[model samples]
Target chain A: MKKFINAVDNVLGESLDGFAAAHADLVTLGAERKFVRRRELNRSKVALISGGGSGHEPLHAGFVGHGMLDAACPGQVFTSPTPDQIVEAAQAVAGDAGVLFIVKNYAGDRMNFEMAAEIAEGRTATIVTDDDVAVEKSTYSIGRRGVAGTLIVEKIVGAAAEKGADLATCVALGERVNARTRSMGVALTSCTVPAAGTPTFALGEDEMEMGVGIHGEPGRRRVKLAQADAIASEMTTAIADDLAAPAGSEALLLVNGFGGTPTIELYLMYNAARRMLEQRGLRIARSLVGSYVTSLDMAGCSLTVSLLDAETTALWDAPVRTAALKW
Target chain B: MKKFINAVDNVLGESLDGFAAAHADLVTLGAERKFVRRRELNRSKVALISGGGSGHEPLHAGFVGHGMLDAACPGQVFTSPTPDQIVEAAQAVAGDAGVLFIVKNYAGDRMNFEMAAEIAEGRTATIVTDDDVAVEKSTYSIGRRGVAGTLIVEKIVGAAAEKGADLATCVALGERVNARTRSMGVALTSCTVPAAGTPTFALGEDEMEMGVGIHGEPGRRRVKLAQADAIASEMTTAIADDLAAPAGSEALLLVNGFGGTPTIELYLMYNAARRMLEQRGLRIARSLVGSYVTSLDMAGCSLTVSLLDAETTALWDAPVRTAALKW
Candidate 1:
């Protein structure tokens, strides 16, 4: 592999070490758990906890700061964190207002987080996000897989929690955001699992994978790679059709990179995606165009549209301080 | 050739269109020129102007919100912006206190920015960043090429300008930041210029390019790619040697990805980089790890270290809302 890493076994450990050491001011690592919480917790607002596999940088970890997540538990790359990690994180970040868990809709993630919420010694609720409309089913998922729309869930719910909303209110807000959002992704190249030391899948140079999952899971099907505008149209059109928002509806668009894609391509994709959304009558409202969510070293892009009203848009625009997805 | 683009000639224009459309709330695009300015411009404060080629997505444009750049002029992909674009942008963004131009040390960028400053109807000063220490000279550059350290100059000076620092003060601050920083980069694979429709250079699957320039220019040498620790040591050692700061000196570390590298790799690189700097007795006071300065879709990274004093660190931490870098 051409990746810059030490032992494959130590990839997640050392990366977390670096994350803790590098962002010491904004967060503090749990003493004996793979969890991170804000450095300054006031214990007045509802605590927000989110976690998943480790490959998606800046998600659960990078989003832990003021006006965002209260705690995050990171597992091995593409592997779900254990229930123990989630419980410890929830306990650590719990405030007087109780806690809310934001779990992506994956078998491993949903099971582990649900178990944690049941066993945690505090009031807790869960909002599972399954916004990826890539497939009706998957090898390891019951429903559509959660993808980039998790960012919208985090931002909106985190803002609500930060504003001293109660745990029930935060949970409702997260569910609403997740339900209103939809995403579809495409991959130009499959990412290598550092441990496997090879690509998860293969494709010819001129071919591409549409409706790809974040973990290099099989996409809708392989197709001859087309132009940037075409790819953007495919992803955005899928998301728009799934969203099925009325012509006069508005949306918060996120053009996410699958780790290895360039910003130029992301912008190109964003241009086409925006046009598609506008032409379809979804007024392009607030948008975030960057790699907030990524598969490991995968070359591709994803389009996510969160149909929005003033409430969701205000929460998104609310000031957030995080290592990732900031404004 | 694998990039998602329309006609090669439309890369820059359409990408800017996506940027403006994507971030219409944060910035306003020129009606007829390639410039982006803050949507809510304040006329009393000094305005910060910086721009160059368009491929570096988040650089001058992404940083064009409240506490960062006031305006950015985008050239065609990998090509310098013409003097006319710069003159119009400089004149438009200039405030009562005047305007400050931040230019990279590339020959074309310098000449065009200098020409624009001369003709713009405002009091202005320029700070050219030349912190890349990969080689004594480069093909399109004299001395050293400006690389990731330009972010430090822009962040520090932009904060100062937003705080009402005079033109002279902002220039002096920017110069100091530029002087105190050093960077070195490497590429595992060459990037393709959308217009060129081919990789800028070729590398074997096992070979790597060390100390490469941002535009995929040759570095000091190419060698078999090493482990992450070894590569980090190489880059940090080179920058630390160039800085030669006294023992226990503080540093602000910026680990920038050249677009294609994964955030996991960037974090791993950051971990190794922090260890190396700490071993050499340089306390890493502030750190930023992301793809802020990119070279299209190149697969590699650059390490920038700016020896920090209390003043510079304070400026770095000041609250600024930019589409790119925000605390």
Candidate 2:
């Protein structure tokens, strides 16, 4: 539960200032509080924008350059950015070619972004990403909670946008990536939010919760901490079965460490998933192992796989320039 | 520490298989033991090959893609990969262009990679990447420990190579990045290597060690847990003072969480560092806040900074395509 900051209220704004300072070439801050694209208005090219809460480091923001998003609006710690902020980011990054907002499936994100889209009615385009497969237990709950799988959607759609794909094409591509990708997570130790200054949830040392939401929401079930292979089997079975990416079909695997899981655990999970897929006759054409998207400092990891095609693979391999990610 | 894997012994091989599966367009694997470049060997470009222990997830391997390395050899768990494996990776990826070796500053990495380079001497070119700024206790000590700073060197040199900069230019650029970058780390809880199945070191809950090495080596000092802002101040002071980046000069800040620190903590630390730098009249031009490079599930983090010029900034912005890094 330890943290470093002068004041809890100023953390996000201060961090953004530091981010802008470090990535001046790729990003610039708008007085309106959005990260504006550094390249002068590429009116000829469609702009891509994505954003949400701040706990997921490098999710919407680290992806804001070159082959990915044109701009990103970071919210306060684990809180959605205001609709006004998103509207400002959308309008600022948009041009004659229009802008695409890649909103995650989360209710807060969806509602805020939808409101932003309304605010930008005449200014930009919007594309919602609903890639998470973990459904809510209650009918009153919002649809599936978007998790790390949204990243694959962002990358693909971002590439399409970079290639001068029209807003429609970009939106369609985003949808395709979402349909083909699925993610599920498990948490070992609940992380504490600095502002809240307490653990988000209570998790015993020997227990883990499966089907976790990115923002520390309760998962499908809590079970005894099992071996790496068992956990991988559990997460991967859910993903593979959902996508129906049977053996022989190529898939790209991403083992994401929730803020606190070590690379060692991620690798172990990756290995177990690979073995399980091999046994299932699935051929993994590529894999990403690390903290691509994270949930603050929660001690856990997630498995995300995007069933790939020639086009998806090409887009996935396309070059990109971002703060956390580089070839 | 909680981990994800079927078995300790199979972690490396399985993860490599998964990586190859996920990034087939960017990389290919040799029979059982080697990873090769997917880009048709541009005989004019120098092929850079690097590898060492497996725990440093993105280092040697995650960097292998356009604008960085040509191939990365994988070793078992935290142990060094064999010379034979490195030689094969080099031969498989090298063309008439020759190859470069980007080894860490560790004795194991240095000795193993050197032997591999020697083995491939007749057929390929090789260069060592020992960019870590942490110093050994004495010259009598084995070697300077390479840490996160090496990633900066890789990106710089890799971009140079992609731009058709030859071996000499790549080496010069690598060294420049090295000279401009410095990193120091601290650990809160000792990392428990899965293979070791126990904490790497002992520490009370309220204690931390600064100047900690990536591989869980004991640090220069162990002290009581300090506030996040205080920790960031201590780390940034060492890095800023070491580089002597003028108090008001533009600085690139990296608030890196060790394997287990939450994003909340990183953000808090980032806010502290930014304020501290600003108070000292330093201008943060850009900042990266996350776990770019990580140790095992060690509950701590490090701070890295590089004073950048136009060239460094350009390199930082160049597009890269790799498994761990994209865009």
Candidate 3:
């Protein structure tokens, strides 16, 4: 595979080092590169920690800052971080208010974060996210795998935590946000893993994998390639149907790229997805279109819809500062 | 080619529609989709206008908003916009302080913008950028091909314009910034133009084009793929040599992806570029890394270095609120 990496074994370390250096004003790397944490921590505010495999960048690590994650433990690509990494991160960032772990619904990640919480100090809680409606079970997940909607959960809950909410309040907010959000993805091409030096899976040029997972896992089905409008229709229908929000409910639409998609196509997808949601009588009160949660260099995009209440909408508008996101 | 597009001809229109929808608070589209202008124009400030081919997104259009371009016209993919489009844009956004056009140094773009400036009303000035050090002349350019450094020119000069710089002052500052900046790119894979339905150019599995242009034009030479550090070294040396800033000079290093490269690789490149800059005795006082200027979905990146003085540094730090960039 053609990639801008020095060595397969050193990809994560070098990239993390570059990330920490480039965003030094916003985040700091944990000892031994186990995690990334906010440069300045508020002692009275509850700390929000989230992490998963490393490929989905700008997710856990890029979200660490004033109005997002306090600490993010990054595992190797598509692999779970060890419990020790999570424990050390919690020990480094946990404050008087307490600590909350935002874990994706993957078996390895769930187990590691659970073990870390059990061994770490302070009042800790876990909010597991399973917002992907793509499938009920996947290669590494028992239920729906957490996908791009995880960004929404982290963003809204992170705002609440930034406002000095208690650990219980943060946990409740996170779970509520996750429940209101749904996501589905379509992959035009499989991503190459550095270590593997090959695409995760083979996809014919004229075909696409619908409802694909973030790890390039098998989705609902592989179908002949369709136009952007059709793909948007299928993905949006899956999300809106699963959300089951009342007609005229306000929502936030996110068109996320799987690393390799360009901004123009993402915006085009957003237009198609927005039209589909409007047809369902959902008001697109807010919208985000870009590659925030990516799956390496996979050529695809994901559509996420989160039913928004007044509180959630207000939180989503709150100020934030971090690498990959700032306002 | 696999792309998220409904029809080749509608890509620009649909994407612009979505962009206007997503950033309604910041920008508005002109009639007939001719240009994208700031939603709230400041009549007291000199208006900054820029336009070029559509494929290099977020360059001209995404930079339109507060503290940046007042209006931007997008042409067809890899093709220059018509003079009528540029004239109409200037007419729509020109304020009492007049308009200053920021044109990339391409044959078509320069010719079109020049014609627009002649036909456009009110006091107007133009600043042309030719920062690429790859080739003295290329397929579409007479001098060096303007590349990623155009963004730095827009940003620094835009900040000055927002601060109420006169039309003449804005032009002079833009020219100065453009003079101080230099860039070089490398492409690992070719991007497919929708209308063409094929890659712009082909490279063997083990080959790469160094000092490539944003449009996948032939570069300095084709060479065997090298490690990230070696590639960074070659690109950084070419830029640093052309820039020729005094030792200990303050500089802004920008690592821009050519659409398809992931954030991990971009940041890693940033690190490599940073080290090279330091080795040359330049202090990296400011850094911007991301896919701001892209070549559709080409898998590669460019390195841009701009010498920064006190005035330019302060201006670069000024607030900007746009779709692709916000602070």
Candidate 4:
């Protein structure tokens, strides 16, 4: 309840207004509300569009700019964006090259973005990512919940689109990247929704939840909080096993903070994960450790491993000028 | 206390290990134990060296790249780095032009950095920044405490050094930037130190501390938490009146989150501040909004405004490659 929001009901509109105001030079509000697009949208390039709930800041919106998503449709907290917002953003940024929709494998998100692509102008393709390795089902989705791997997919696919790849090419790359990546998360505490004015769920003072979803829903199970190294080992091993990456294979180990974790903690988690990977003979190629993905003030962290070859690695290192992921 | 650290005493070393490991492509651990330096050290340019307590991630180490600090020495959590660490960093990164030491206005930090500069090889200049407008003195600092403004000073001075400015020129520019910047902060909750294993202070559920320091020390006073607009108005007006920012002047707005605060709240605070600045007729020419500076797990935010002329704005806009701040 101590959040810095003006009102529970207006969190979405006001937060978006603040976002547009702060990043005026980089992005703008689409003709339709809840839609954010790059200010310097190029009508000739393949427009990349992706979005979901509102609590995960800098996800879709912060990723909008040169060499990234052309637009993002941010819904209310822990809610899927409406199709109208996506359709408007798609039409605004669509060109002769067409558009591609990047959807996380959530029922509402999949249905909404899919419907938007159906009605939107020009050719379109949808690549649904279900990267979470924690569980096969959650409260909001029948399949795995897409977590931090979506960011890696966005970066790789966004780079391809920037290089004048066609809509089909972008979709192929997104799916390829998604197949090579996996993510898992743990929650130390549940995040309270502003509208609810209370935690989404409750846990004992000494207890923690593993395999937690981004929306503060129940994870695999609630258990006693373990030491950092133990927690790190569990999460890292889960992600590494899920990838089944071959020996000597390189990867981009992404240690994403699930909002509310400090940078110091994220770095410590990185250390624990690195030790595990090194011992397993998996070549630690590149790494990004920070809160790139989050679950609104939830005190926990997640790990994602994107197996990288020369092509994907090059795209990952390609110059990107977005508010969040920039190299 | 809930944190991601492996051990209380090992927090500094393990985190530094992870930082070096994660950004090995751009930085390396100086032969000395805790010093972090750019991998591409240029011998012909003036070297910018900074360090302090370890909790503030993405400050000194994350800024060690193309257009920022050449090296940084991180101490144990919430403690000033030793003189040996700073001296080693200064010696390692020193170029033909010599080294410039950027010191925050904390007793331990100032003394250690000053001592290091005295012993380090080659010419050395120390510029202490005291831009915290919250108070003239604090528990740890004799004069003003250097808060988020230190990030601005480093960015501006580092850019000046990259353009081959002399050591004196870089020092003068850093001091000028410091003089033109001011900051203030508010905390809704206290941060618990990993070693201490307890919150620094306690407040009622509805209370907040204004003009709080980054270390979670006592501020001016505690009062009931206000709405986002009222809080923003108080903090923004305090900084604006302190700077005496001209009605038509252009300035860079830095909205920083203190580790645990969510991005939505930071944006809400940003929106409120933007309105106040526009009412005062100050143009926000540039803004770097994110959790660039932080206190571990503290639920609060701080604002830094740097009054920029044409020259400073260009320097601020200059391209710099680092793990945290870029472009």
Candidate 5:
């Protein structure tokens, strides 16, 4: 496949420089090569920091701001950010309230962030977000893979910090959001990283993989392209079955575009999902329909549901200010 | 090129269903197709409603929530949502404080929103957001097109409203944010709308276009691909020259990936831009780098700068809660 890039090697470095130049107001690069918090630290509040691969734009970096993360480490394209970078980010942004590290449940991310957290354990409080419901057997593996649900946890935990909630409060809230949230994704095609300059994996035009990882890895199952409504049903149903939440329970639905799917198509899939849920007597109390978390330029989406209580809803409704998402 | 769609006609409706099912906690669609506000409307608070085309995902619908818009109408891909949809959205969301319409500066959007605004003129306070820096003239023939700047205005104004700033305050703040913002875009390759099933425009391997719009329309000028640094220089120079805010002035820089450009490349461009600005002695106080607003699978990105002041910054920092964005 053809790609638009100057050189494969220079793609990542050049891109970071360009991003910093354009967004001088909200972010600054630390000496260790990561975007640090631009907002003034309240000192009384605990700072939240998270980062991983670079392909997930708003995830690691775009989320840096007031009511969210204080800093993000952007690793090379699809790779994990280094421990050194995470260490610098923690030191640069930490305050008296301390810093919370919200690392995703990936092996590389876990290893790196945990190492950094261990190194900075004396300086900041650390927490892991294993919100992905896709994996359940932590007995044999590291843990559940953190996915888009991490954003929900970050926002809730960040808001707790902004509201003068202690580190313990923030950590508890983070775990609560993570516990309530579940996500599963599918990919229609594997996208080529600019530096890689080739498709991550090959798939037929008519075939799509369900339960796909965001980093262009193979999914649990490959299936034929079905009707939009049918595919959405499959994805949402899988999530519902995993949670085993009753049909009548109130829930928050998130239909996230992996990257390349158009908003129009996402909305179409959203409409189908609503019908399927209504048929099952489920009450949708809230919904988020967009590409909040993306998989490079892959052409597919994921479905996430968070069973809600009054407290989680209130936390979700708390205001947050960030680079990628602002209200 | 190959795609995974099962059919074209059912794309929108089905996606909407899937989205509602997935995000059932953050929003819900009224039977009439209105994306209703998830939070309980404070009886005395004014409601904000916005909508236009379907492809701009988080815009109209995703903005609906506590501090942003109360309702959104989703159009077919690249096409304006029908007048009836807008009217319904206005009626469903409007309350004692009235409703404000934040319409982008597109011809079809203006016409449809204008007509819908007329329908609710007597019942609600209608405010139109004509914040596109590209559209300098009020007259249709030479007017600037609205782009990423509209999203900023929406967020700021929405926050002001949520803080109990009256309808007039929201309107005034929205206008101020728009006045302070300017945006320009470039495309390396044309986007492919799923229904069209091919690229909207054919670009050569070494070609790029400047001053491109979001819909994959031909840009003001086509040129050869330059170094990433050179591309950043040209794009920023044009935007800076147009705004003429002077060096050393603090501004909020937004480097938005249209659709396909990865975050790494965006950050590289941002770093280049920062050096360019710093060398010119400009101060960037805050920056937003992501793909918040986008075209349909477009292979390009846009840069937006909103010169900041205490008032704008305060408004920017005000808390907000929405489906797509928070804080």
Candidate 6:
């Protein structure tokens, strides 16, 4: 595969080094490259920490700042972080209000974050996200795999925490946000892991993988390539039906690209998805369209629908300062 | 070509609809979708206007908002906007302080923007950006083709305009910034325009186009794919040698992705480019790493370096709110 990489093992470390240096005003890298934490921690606020494999950039680490995550522990590409890394991160950022772990529902991630919570000091809690409506079980996850909805959870819940929510309040807000959110993705092409040096999967020229996972895992089924509106109809119908929010309910529509999709196409998908959601009687009150949670260099996009109440809407509108997100 | 688009003709219109919808708080689409203007225009400030082909998103339109362009016109994909679009945009946003058109150094773009200025009834000025150091002339232009450095020019000059710089001052600052900035790109794969329905160009499995243009035009040379450091060294040396800045000069380093490159690889490139610049004795006072300016779905990246003086540094740090960039 043609990629900008020095070596397979040094990918995460060197990327993190560059990330820290570029965003030096906002975040700091921990020793041994164990974690990325806010440059100035708020000692009175509850700490929100989240992380997973390295491919889904601007997720946990990019959201680390004033109104989002306190710290993030990144693992190798498509690999879960060790408990030691998590424990060290918690120790570094957990304040008087305590620490809350925002993790995707992958088996490896759940187990590792749980172990770290157990070993860490002070009050600690966990909010496991399983917002993907594609499948109830997958090869790497027992429940629905958390996808782009993870970003929504981090933003809303992190805003609440930034406003001085306690540990229990932060946990409740996070779990509620996760439950109210749903996401589904389609892959136009597979991504190549730097180490593997080949695409993770292969498809015919006119085929696509519907409801694909973030790590290039198998999706619901492979289907013929379709128009933007048709694809949007399928993904939006699935998410809206699964969400089952009342008609005319307010919602946030997010179109997330899987690394290789262009912003123009992402916005095009957003237009199609917004039309579909409006037809389904959901009011698009807030929207985010970009490549926030990516899957290496995969060429695809995911549509996330999050049911929003007044509190959540206000929280999402709250001011935030992060590397990838700010207002 | 696998892309999330409906019909080739509808690509720019539909994407602009979504962009306007997503950033309703910051911008508004003009009638007939000829231009994107700031939602709340500042009548007393010099209106910064820009336009070009559509594929390189977040360049003209995404930068239209507070502390940036007052309005931006978008043409068909890879085609320069018409004079009518530019004239209408000038009519919509030009105020007491008049209008300043920031045009890229392309034959089509320069001609169209010049025609619009002649017809536009206002105190209008022009800033033509020719920052590409790859070649003196390419397929699309008479001189160096403007690449990612246009973003830097918009940002710095837009900041000055926001702070009440007159038409002449804005033009002078923009031209100076353009002169100080230099950029070069490398493409691993060619982008497939929707209308063409095929790759714009081709490359062997182990080949790359160095100093490639944003439109996938031929670069300085096609060479065997090299390691990340080797590529970074060649690109950095070309820019630094051409810039010929003082050893201790302050500079801003921007590593921009060409749509299809992942954030991981972009940051890795940022790391490599940062090291090379430091070795050349330039103090990197500012850094921006992401896909701000892009070719449709090209898998590559471009590096941009702009010398920053005390005045430009503060302008760079000034608060601006746009769809793609905010701080």
TM-scores for all predictions? 0.96, 0.83, 0.98, 0.97, 0.77, 0.98
Position A202, candidate 1: lDDT: 93
Give the TM-score (vs. native) of candidate 3.
0.98
DockQ of 1: 0.72
Off by over 4 Å in 3: A137-141, B137-141
Q: Residues B1-327, candidate 2, lDDT per residue (tens digit)?
A: 466655667666766766665556777777775554555555568887777777766566767788888878877756777889888777676666677787776778788887877777544444444434446436636645667777777777888888888777777777777777777788888877767877888988678887887777778899888866777778877776667776667667777766787655675577677777777766877666666567767777777777778888888768877755556
DockQ comparison, 2 vs 3, better candidate: 3
Question: Taking the tens digit of each residue's C-alpha lDDT, what string does model 3 give over A1-327?
Answer: 888988999899998988998888999999999999999988688988999999988788999998988999999998889999999998889878888899888888999998998899888899989988888545643888888889999999999989878888888899999999999999999999899999989999899999898997767899999999999999998898888899999999999999999999999999999998999999999999899999999999999999999999999999999897787
Per-candidate DockQ values are 0.72, 0.40, 0.81, 0.73, 0.37, 0.83
Number of clashing pairs per prediction, in order: 0, 33, 0, 0, 75, 0
Q: What digit string (tens of lDDT, one per residue) describes model 6 on residues A1-327?
A: 989988888988889999999999999999999999999988789988898988998777999999999999999998889899999998899877889999998989999998998899989999989888898545543778888999999999889999988889989999899999999999999999998989999988899999998998867899999999999999999999899999999999999999999999999999999999999999999999999999999999999999999999999999999999897
What does candidate 3's lDDT look like per residue over B1-327, in tens digits?
999999998999999999999899999999989999999978888989999998898788999989889999999998888889989988888878998999888888999998888888898899999889887555643788888999999999999999989999999999999999999999999999888999978899999998888876767899999999999999889888888888999999999999999988988898888998999999998988889999999999999999999999999999999888888
Model 4 / residue A134 / CA error / Å: 0.7
Per candidate, chain B TM-score? Answer: 0.97, 0.91, 0.98, 0.97, 0.91, 0.98
Q: What is candidate 1's lDDT per residue for B1-327, written digit by digit as tens? A: 677788888778788888888778788888575689899988888889899987887887999987889999998877888888888786677767988888998989999987887788868888889999887644643688888999889888888888889988998889999999999999988888887888988899888999897886766787987899999999888888889999999999999999989998898899999999999999998889999899888899999999999888888889877878766
lDDT of 4 by residue, A237-292 (tens): 88787788778999889998877888888888898898898787788898999887
Per-residue accuracy of model 4 over B1-327 as CA lDDT, tens digit each: 777766688887888888889988889997645699999989799999998887877777899999999999888777899989988887778878988989888888998887787778789999998888888544643789998999999999999899999988998899999999999999988998888899999988899999987887878889898898898889888888888977988998899999988887788788888788878888987877788788888989998989998888888989898988877
Ranking by DockQ: 6, 3, 4, 1, 2, 5
Candidate 5 per-residue C-alpha lDDT over B47-138 given as tens digits, one digit per residue, 9 for 90 to 100: 77777776666566666777677777878777777778877776666767777778777789888887876776444554444434433465
Interface residue Cα RMSD of candidate 6 after superposition: 0.6
Give the true-contact fraction for every prediction, in order: 0.70, 0.54, 0.64, 0.64, 0.62, 0.70
Off by over 4 Å in 6: A137-141, B137-141
lDDT of 5: 0.72
- Candidate 1 lDDT over A245-317, as tens digits, reads 8889988889999899888778878898888889999888887888888998889988999988998888888
